[model samples]
Target: MKNSQLYKGSLNTIILKLLEEKGRMYGYEITQKVKEITNGELAITEGALYPALHKLEAEGFLEAEVEKVDNRLRKYYKLTENGQLETANRLSELEEFIRNMQTLVHPKWSY
Candidate 1:
């Protein structure tokens, strides 16, 4: 990410939203998807990605399944029931945050 701090707080939400859309994804796929979606403005690093994935899995928001693809094992993540609900909630909160930031950054004038 060009301004990782700006996006850091929303990483979990971002992951949730992606999994919700893609159904399931492995770690590297998630990283590449984010980069592709953002036209490379955002690059999710393994250092940042795995801990968040582990945290979400521990929190019951995600579940992982490992599969052998070719000769390597790939762990994929998908949203749990709770995760689906949480995605809606988090998306609402993120949208509101963006709207609030927009208001602050580009306020309308009242005469």
Candidate 2:
């Protein structure tokens, strides 16, 4: 993202959520999808994206399959059983965070 620090903490959750929605996606596909979803406001760099993907894979939250598509090999990631469960938890946490931030940023006026 343009403001990386603000969004860095949520990267993993974002990835998991996207994978949950897309079923399976390659790294570049994930990056492009996020760009498309956010209308280019957020851009995930390879430096950031790969590590998150690797970490998720190591945590058993994702599974990767390598296949030769057309001419080049592509790695596709799909959510595992644990990932499915984690996605729910991550989304819930993210929703709560957003609500909290909203309250803090725009508190209701009381007389």
Candidate 3:
């Protein structure tokens, strides 16, 4: 799960889903949550994470707010209205993709 190539394409969708579920989260918090959820199998690196966040923010699918925590500013990301709809759409798409991959990988079971 820590394989970047395998999970890179899904990062945005993952972030969206997480935001939808958790309301809002900072970058570090997001990485920790994902690691915890995956039982340390998956680790999100800051290298991939920040770019995805900036892209989401630029696309208006997410909104960021800065708050002072521990005497330092932290940027927390949340899904916007469009992001909510997009998250639902992306989730559906991912579900279909998963089914398709499963079918291809286990053709006998797909029958």
Ranking by lDDT: 1, 2, 3
lDDT of 2 at 94: 90
* lDDT of prediction 3: 0.94
Q: RMSD to native for every prediction?
A: 1.0, 1.2, 1.8
- Tens digits of per-residue lDDT, candidate 3, 1-111, equal 476687988999999999999999999999999999999988999999999999999999999999999999999999999999999999999999999999899887534
Error of 3 at 8 (Å): 0.7
- Going through the candidates in the order shown, the clash numbers are 0, 0, 0
Best TM-score among the predictions, by candidate number:
1
User: Could you give candidate 1's per-residue lDDT for residues 1-111 as a string of tens digits?
Assistant: 465699999999999999999999999999999999999999889999999999999999999999999999999999999999999999999999999999999999899
Report the alpha-carbon TM-score of model 3 versus the true structure.
Answer: 0.94
Q: How many residue pairs in model 2 have overlapping backbones?
A: 0
Task: State the displacement of the C-alpha of residue 31, model 2, in Å, after optimal TM-score superposition.
Answer: 0.5
lDDT of each: 0.96, 0.96, 0.94
Cα TM-score per model: 0.96, 0.95, 0.94
Write the residue-wise lDDT of candidate 2 on 1-111 in tens digits: 475788999999999999999999999999999999999999999999999999999999999999999999999999999999999999999999999999999999899
Candidate 3 segments exceeding 4 Å error: 109-111
